[model samples]
Target chain A: MISSIFSQLFQTLLIVVLAPLLLGWVNQCRAWLQNKRGAGVLQPYRVLHKLFHKDAVLADNASSLFRTAPYIQFACMVLVASIVPMVATDLPFAAAADVIALVGLFALARLFAALAAMDIGTAFGSMGARREMLVASLAEPALLMILFTPALIAHSTSLTTIVEALAHREFVLYPSLAFAAVAFAMVALAENARIPVDNPATHLELTMIHEAMILEYSARHLALIEWASAIKLSNYSAIGIALFLPWGIASAGDWNAVPLALAVLFVKLLLGGAGLALLETLSAKLRIFRAPEFLGTAFLLAVLGMLMLEL
Target chain B: MATFTGQLINFLAALLLLIAFAMLSQRRILSLIHLFAWQGFILALSTTVVAYSTHQPHLYYSAFLTLVLKAFLLPWILHRLIIRLNIKWDVETMINVPTTMLVGIALVIFAFNLAAPISQLADTITRSTLGIAMASVLLSFLMMITRHKAVAQVVGFLAMENGLFFAATSATYGMPMVVELGIALDVLVGTFIFGIFFFQIRETFDSLDIKNLEKLKED
Candidate 1:
């Protein structure tokens, strides 16, 4: 009991502190791929430190929701980190939240972020909120279908149960999971506002999605949102690991295996981060109108995955 | 142990269905042909596996025929035809892509429900894959109807043939070897005739879009 609690606390803290490092690693990789010297892997930490030390500036018309949105978003992301079975599946929080609840938590955070974006009444903020909603509506169904593919195989919606089912199964190629992985990668790219959906590094007002929503934020509020987004990216990567390549994750109450599990998770994340950078490097951003087709293809792929399993 | 090969066959069938969807939504004529080639290659691979597992030696010939005719020869000919014709535009869909995808999904469901009873009566280890084979066929037919370009439709037609070959392998362990050979010759001859027709049509209409053929009836 005590060890699981300790492990859970350790994972939560690790995710909070290391999430920015993952972001920085991805950025560094992108830089290397583009043939430029990177700002280094610790750049996110420096930016967070600078933001936290400065006073936040708010618009005169900003509502309380605007002030509180960052905290809600940050708390939601942390809760998600705690719930997902990252290095270990034995955490107490895993039983409390299944995949559905995890999605709901993400939706709640997005709802707050969109609401807050619209709160300022700025043209860019409202436009960003609308676009975010459009993406969420398309992406959420695909995400659900992707999760349900493994869920059906495991016969449970709980992430731990699904992980246990997939990890312990005899080596057999599942064409359905292959399709689901492709669909999940597409949804993840879009949900995280990565290149091909929305370029994170670009500030061109016409093309930005996530960046536009937070254009008015400065100092700590921006910092918190940035941190929350980093965590969100990690959460998605962890979910993907838990679902598809879950061989190395420590099972519940496997205290002795935690160290090995941590090593495996680190290697997986490192490879996954580099893979994300490579994908971003290879693909150009789609026209905003084309995002629907990209995500629609994702939805169809996920549905196809489910249908294959049914067959 | 018996279920292992069954699972692998299912996986391949799922891949065939995925390729069908990809071909359905693909816009470029060149990539469409590429996808068609991949579909043929997977079909050949699956047939080879089925042959090895079931000890049906004649199915091996069928597999080789699929590999050469569908995967290599057909794609090579189509590639040359497109290059010779100087056709580079995205294959226009009659409806939008998303709507076509939705209709494709509906067709898949219909195909599954349509095949379920027939699949239940089959005794092959790959009997479960019958629905996927049927779905791919229907999806290719959907692709055929939705595409406006002649080359795209022909690729769709070839993909539909691939689906039928998969169905034969899964359902009845392939047709008799002579019939397989005959069908192969027929497909090759049909492609040659289609190639001739392509030039004749382009010479008459100055374009490959089939919509231009409607003017002949108007006169």
Candidate 2:
């Protein structure tokens, strides 16, 4: 009993600490793919440390929501980190929320972020807010459909139940899951502001979506939001791993398998991060107007995946 | 082995339907032709698998004919037609892509509903794939109706044929070898005639858009 509690605590702590490292690793891989020497893998930590030490600069008319939005976003991400079965499926926090609730948490964070973006009434901020909402509206349905594909197969909406069912099942190729994975990858790219949807590295005022909204933040508030974004990226990666590749995650009361699970999780993340970098390098950013078509295709693929399973 | 074969056939069928949707939404003429070729390749592959698993020796010949004619020869002809016509970058669509995609989805659902009863009555190892086969046919027909360029229409027509071939293979262990051979000859001759007609249309209208042919109608 005590070991379960200890493992839960350990998993939560690991998610929080490892998120920024994952971001740093993806960025480093991107740089390497572009044939540039990268800042070390610890660059995100250094940046976070620097931001936390500086004073926050706020707008003269900034509201309380503006000040607290960063914290809310950060907290939501942390809660999500705890809920997803990353290293182990038996974490206590996994019971607190099912897949739908987890999606709600993401929407909540996004709503807060968008509300805060429009609070100061800057032109760029409002524009960014509109674009972000547009992407979210299109992506959210597809996200739910993608989640439901596995839920239908496992006969449960709880992430832990789904993971356990899939992990213990006999080996068989599921074509519906193949469609769901493709749809999931597209939605993830769009939701995370990655290349082909919104370029994360670009700060061009006209083309930037995520950065334009947070343009006014600095110091501690900026640090928290950036950290939250990192956590969000890792959150998505963990969810993908949980759904499609849930084999190595340790089940509850299996203390002997925890070490091996951790190693497998690490290797999966490493390969996944590099694969993401390769994809980003190979594709160019779509024009802003084309984003709807991209997300629309994702939605269609997800629906087709569900239909394949049913019909 | 039998179960694996069934699963593999289902996977290939899903891919066939997906390629049909891709062709439906694609705007570039060259890309449309490429997707058509890919659809043919997958169709031939699925036919080969069905042949191997069901111990039908004639399907092996049908698959070989489909692979050579639909996958290689037809695409090669279309590529050369596009080069001679100088219309490689055409992107005109009578309906926007997203709306067309929504309509395509509806067609797929309708096809599945329509095929369910028919598939249930069939006693083949590949019966489950009949719905996907029908969906691809409807989607290809939708593509044919939505595009303005004559070349895209031709590609869509050929893709519709692909869906029909898939349907025949999946539903009935393929047509008799003689009928398959005759249809292959018909498609090859039809493609040649279509190529000649494209030139005639281009020479008469000075463009490849089928809408221009409206001038031939009397007011």
Candidate 3:
């Protein structure tokens, strides 16, 4: 029992620590693919540290609600990161919340952030708030529908149960899963404010959705939000891996299973980060109005995936 | 009968249904053609799979004919016809897309319910796929009704034939060899006639929109 606690703690620390590294790796890969000398992979960590040490600057009209939102969002992310079965299955904490609650966790974080954005009363912030809500309203349903396929396949909604079922099942290519994976990958990219949904690297003000919402944040508030976004990206990638590529994760209670699982996770993260960067570099961002159509396609694919499960 | 092959055939049948839905909702004429061709390709693949597993030789020839006639020849001919007609842009539908999709879903459920008893009567390895085959035919018919252009309707008509052909292979191991040959000739000749009809329609009305044909009926 004590070892389970220790492992859960380790998993929490691992998700928080690796989140920024994954973001930095994607950025570095994007730069390299664009034929430019890139910022090092440790750049996000340095930015986080610098922002933490700086003094926070608040608007004259800032509310207590605005001041409290960054922490709430950050806490939600940490809690979500802690519960998802990343390195080990059958973790004692996996039962605390299932996949649906995990989605609710994400939505809670977005709600806090959007509320904070509106609290500032700035034009850009409100516009960004509206856009973020629009994107989320479309994305959340697709996200739930995407989870339905694996949940149905595993016959459970708990993350660990689903992961264990996939790890133990005999291997065959599933059409429903293939369609869901594609849809989930698209949603993840959109939810993380990546390319073809919203460019993470663009500086043009009108082209921004995520960055606009954070225009008022400075110092550690910015640090926490930035870290939360990184955590969001890592959380999504881990969920995708747990569903579509379920091998090498340790479910046994043996103490010796830890090292191989960690090594496997590192390799998976590295490949996932590089592939995300490659895709972001290849695709152009769509017009804001067209985002609904993109998410609609994801929804269509998810619906088809569920229907395919029946056939 | 390996379970793996059974599952694989089921997966392909689902893909055929997916393409059928795509055809039903697709707005662009070019993409509708592509979806039709994809249906043909999946149909051919499923047939080949069934033939290999069931030790049927004639289904292989029908599969080849399907690949050439539906996948390659018809799409190529349709693409050429549209480019020559310059009517490749617009494909108006009778109803909005969401309504069409909802009705398509209802049709799929109905097909599943209808095919249940019939599938139990068949002894083929892919008998369970009968529902999907029927769903594809209904979806193609839906596409034909919703589409406004003559060319799009023609593609929909051809896609319905593809579904019917898929239904034959899955239910009874395909029709006789002579019947298969006759259908192939009929489809090829039909496409050519449709091509000539397209030119005459354009020449007579200066457009390919079938709504103009309503004027002839009224007069």
Candidate 3 is graded, for docking, as acceptable
Interface RMSD for model 1 amounts to 1.2
Superposed Cα deviation of residue A107, candidate 3 (Å): 0.9
Model 1: docking quality category? medium
- Best DockQ among the predictions, by candidate number: 1
Model 2 chain B: lowest-lDDT 10 consecutive positions: B210-219
**Residue range A1-311, candidate 1, lDDT tens digits:** 89889988998898989999999999999999999999999999999999999998899999999999999999999999998888888888788999999999999999999999999999999999999999999999999999999999999999989998898889977888999999999999999999999999988989899998999999999999999999999999999999999998888888788899999999999999999999999999999999999999999999999988867
Q: Where does candidate 1 stray beyond 4 Å?
A: B214-219
The local distance difference test score of model 3 is 0.89
DockQ of each: 0.77, 0.72, 0.46
Best by TM-score: 2
Report the C-alpha lDDT of model 2 over B16-64, residue by residue, as the tens digit.
9899988888878888889888988999999999999999999999999
TM-score of chain B, candidates 1 onward in order? 0.97, 0.97, 0.96
Off by over 4 Å in 3: B88-90, B94-103, B217-219
Candidate closer to the true structure by TM-score (higher is better), 2 or 3? 2
Flag clash pairs in model 2.
none
Ordered from best to worst DockQ, the candidate numbers read: 1, 2, 3
User: Candidate 2 residues A228-277, lDDT tens each?
Assistant: 99999999999999999998999888878889999999999999999999
What TM-score, computed on C-alpha atoms, does each candidate reach? 0.97, 0.98, 0.95
